[model samples]
Target: MHQFISVTFSLLVITGLRVSVQAGETRPERSISRHYISELTVTNGGRWGSWGHKEMCPTGTYAAGFSLKVDSAPYAQTNDITALNGIRLHCIDNYRRSLNQYHEYSTVRSEVGSWGRWTDIKWCPSGFLRGFALLVEKPQNTGDNKAANNIAFVCSGGAVLIGSGTNWGEYGAWSKTCEGKGICGIKTRIEEPQGSGDDTALNDVTMFCCS
Candidate 1:
């Protein structure tokens, strides 16, 4: 019940730098275009039951934690940015199949309304490995379906890690901003490049689905 494999991509992202993943090869040669991922709910509790839910970055703005591309093999497609190197799988095994293991939204802060703010960022859900906490929906007008609270960047729904600083500190935000409406925005559809270099500098993202 702890066997993970997630690589969903179509490319269309570019933020800070250093996206690495390929230490032991938990499957990250790149290939996935959007389906849903069996329902993504397996990191420990296990529940890839239905197997049909793969939407790996399509709406736009894709970026998670650390994906600076160092050996993902070649970046694959969409907007191609290959140097590929993604694979960390330790957040409790990285794809918990989903059920209950993601509820801690509010770490990188700095809100005043102007699209800019994140201090002392923090997102902990790797209590051994079992990820699923990348929920941050915006566009609140009181009638816009409401969604604006959830962002630590944790996706095992498959692939996405590009780092530089805790939620854009050293540098992140070159492009990818899910403003709001319908999907209501809230996708760590990360995209960095504001400062650059040394800020913990890490990238272990994995996603390849665009054939």
Candidate 2:
């Protein structure tokens, strides 16, 4: 019986180690060759939540499109409102390529809130994303507060792309344009759900430009 128990324990140890290695492999390593050229930020982001991990596009790629995660209006109005939940960056290898011509690409995002559904991706007609503006609602002392509502991105091709997010807050000034090729990474500030208090999911965001 002791021999059998010892074998079982050994197997468990080996299995645990294998699982750990596999989990580590799932997270891609950041390449040293890919460096951020500038950080884009706005002033009107909500004053809630902690900043999430910064996620970046793979080497040789830049962000050319984006999507939003937004809570349904009916659900938000009835329950604790958290309008903009998350933002995702869709990357492409060639910024000059047309929207429909790209066949292979990758998507990346930082931390996302627990609420809302991801919207369809909005792509730039040409070039990469260079600047951004955010819409945010002011604090409500006693009413429902939805911090970040929508986002707009300015492409290097001079096209402006807007997201399908809730219309709650006013848009802030556009962030400084990318000093390099385009925006390549994203980091967000999100507030977790409060048990019985006001909850504002996405508060702020920062964009990283890469050369």
Candidate 3:
């Protein structure tokens, strides 16, 4: 019986079914090479609910991210502008990470009340994007912006981060002409055209410690 049991265990290991080995010396863990912040739904009425969600970002050199799903009709000819129109995405791991990593901010633009959506990839902040503050209204055109406030997790500095990276990375952008057909027709683009609806949007944010 003992010999039969040993043979069965050996077979399991050989076939890669299941097996256990003696504990070896622990090695340091390297950070993961990539990450994507996901599963975004929004309400313009929520409190710092935006800042409330950054707890999920694992530590490392990651691009910043945030998304929203809103009522398409209201967002199209969109109205109201406030910090709370969207959420504020910030970092908890603020020891080594600086507020300088948020870069290359972008998203596909859409305005559908239900199915289709848009991502507006644009320069999020002129200042360092360390922490964000969200309120319950949309950002009105202060003679600068021309569209309604779509629910978004604002990043501070997505451009500078992209320029500093050595490897070619991925990011969302305001596309007048996105490739169309990936992630609910949301993909990389040069212009974030605002239309209507919920799409798989993305924000390429740099990791940073808040001030």
Best by lDDT: 2
lDDT of 1 by residue, 1-211 (tens): 0111122122114211221233321322111343322222211111111122122333221222322212121222222222111112211112321222222111110111112222221212121111332221222234211111222233323233322222211111112222221110111122222133111111211122111
Return the candidate ranking by TM-score, descending.
2, 3, 1
Error in Å for residue 51 of model 3? 11
lDDT of 3: 0.24
Model 1, runs deviating above 4 Å: 1-22, 35-65, 70-162, 165-211
lDDT of 2 by residue, 1-211 (tens): 2453343335432221011111212233333345788899999999999999888889888888788889866655476778899998777777434544444556788888888887776777778889998989999988888899988888887667777788776788889999888999999999998878888999999999998
| lDDT for each residue of candidate 3 in 146-186, tens digit (9 for 90 to 100) | 12223222233322211111111112222121121111111
Worst 10 residues of 3 by lDDT: 181-190
Better of 1 and 3 by lDDT: 3
Q: Which candidate gets the maximum TM-score versus the true structure? A: 2
| lDDT measured at residue 200 in model 1 versus the true structure, 0 to 100 | 12
- Backbone clash total for model 3 is 47
